[model samples]
Target: MHYVTSKTLLSSNNGMNLYRGCTHGCIYCDSRSECYNMNHDFEDIEVKQNSAELLKKELLKRPKSMVGTGSMTDPYIPIEKNLKYVRKSLEMIYRYGFGFTCITKSDLVLRDLDLLEKINERSKAVVQMTLTTADDDLCSILEPNVCVTSRRVEVLKTLSEAGIPTVVWLCPILPYINDSHENINGILDFCIESGVHGIICFGMGLTLREGNREYFYKKLDENFPGLREKYVEKFGDSYTVSSPNNRELMKIFKKRTDEKGILNDNDEIFRYLHNFPQDSVQTKLI
Candidate 1:
């Protein structure tokens, strides 16, 4: 909830984060890792007060491309209800004739459905949502601050109905916790039913670095009792924590997504996301 004047908005890759840090109390947030090096508390939320203006300048200078956000933090956190920086930035992106994409887990995205649809019509607008667990109660524990999985599915359906392509991030499977076929199948079923364009799942595992590792372990100790000790015994300090069922679960993920004609390959989905349609550029020129 703090604002600071920022020098720039978009990265060389055309990605922009309207806010830094997050309020979404996800126990397994990799952004909390020390490698990112945020100066303030994770919940403090650094705001780029002049992001809209900076984005306008950047967009006017560059050719039409897909501008993405919410990689480092969710732009639709509760603070967004009052700040509305994301909404303002969307207006700027649309006004400048650039494509837009975002990764979010909150139903708050529904509030901006009008603008997303408009951008899709003019260029392209893809909504990428992360669905870690299908169980609502488990979802609440894993991602405490955002909307549940079912609600996120509804948001995806609504976006699809609006003609906006949707992508799902099925990740951080939290080995030994949600690495079950039932959870994977449940989430994939939701994706198929919602008609998602793709699903990105690296594997049935979660990574833990220094900062996030401590936080995750602490949460496990608090909630799951002896689970922290079990993790320590199994994976002393390894960064990548893959599940025993990673191979099997991946098979299910690939089979389901492939059968439904949904994009499951990470590279393909990223290429699709970063690609700016030629028609959009042509329309901009016209």
Candidate 2:
């Protein structure tokens, strides 16, 4: 990892990424795509050294509070164990009394659970975990380096039990691989059983770009022989690879989450995440 002082930390949308690359090595990682124009190798994380300071400075000026992280890169990467940048930033957000949300696939996030609970108490703190496959072996092939689905489900259970709102990203259900009825239903069962507040699934498909497309196809050939040929034959150069069973499996995902009272629609979930409740704002006003 290399350090650089960033000109700004927060985006116009109130989201911030402390690092510009990830080491979790998810085969379908959109962050690795060329369009982002990350000048460094995806694994050689670009650390925004001034992130905590910049965040604190920016939060002091904001009239309202709602900050999110880990959209482009996993904030809880292994390097966070030594650097604790995300933890320090969280402390700043908590001290400033701003709501916080992070999407990650690492159990390393649990290290800051105490701070997260405090933030939730003061305002709101939502943790989003991505679950793509229920089968552990398949998960290893899909995500490669991060924690498996079962352990992530356990993390969700732990967070839910701690009174921290949790959301699940049931996405990138790779076609010809984990995009099956059983896989989708299995992950949904975990979400229901774990008591997640919401699930964000943008169709049962994965998007591929220049860098990520090559990596994913290589992995497909290595892990599931002949699958790459099938993808080439079907998708060619298309970006979105929707599963053949997308309609049926999506029906299952919607029906299960609706029955369980978990927010299922992507738009509704985004609104819930970004729109701070009037009650919380009123209390802040007081």
Highest-scoring model, lDDT: 1
Please give the RMSD to the true structure for each candidate, in Å. Answer: 1.5, 2.0
Tens digits of per-residue lDDT, candidate 1, 164-272, equal 9999999889878999999999999999999999999888999999899999999998778899999999988999999989999999998888888999889999999
- CA lDDT of each candidate? 0.91, 0.87
User: What TM-score does model 1 achieve against the real structure?
Assistant: 0.97
Quick one: how many clashes does candidate 1 have?
0
In terms of lDDT, the poorest run of 10 residues in model 1 is: 277-286
All candidates: TM-score: 0.97, 0.96
Q: Compared to the true structure, candidate 2 yields what TM-score?
A: 0.96
What is candidate 2's lDDT per residue for 1-286, written digit by digit as tens?
8999899999888899988888888888887889988898889989999887888778878856678995899999999999999999888877777788999999998999999998888788899999999899988878878899999999999999999999999988888788888898899889989999999999989999898999888878788899899999999999898999999998998898888899988898888788654455323321
Pairs in clash, predicted candidate 1: none
**Candidate 2 — which pairs collide?**
none
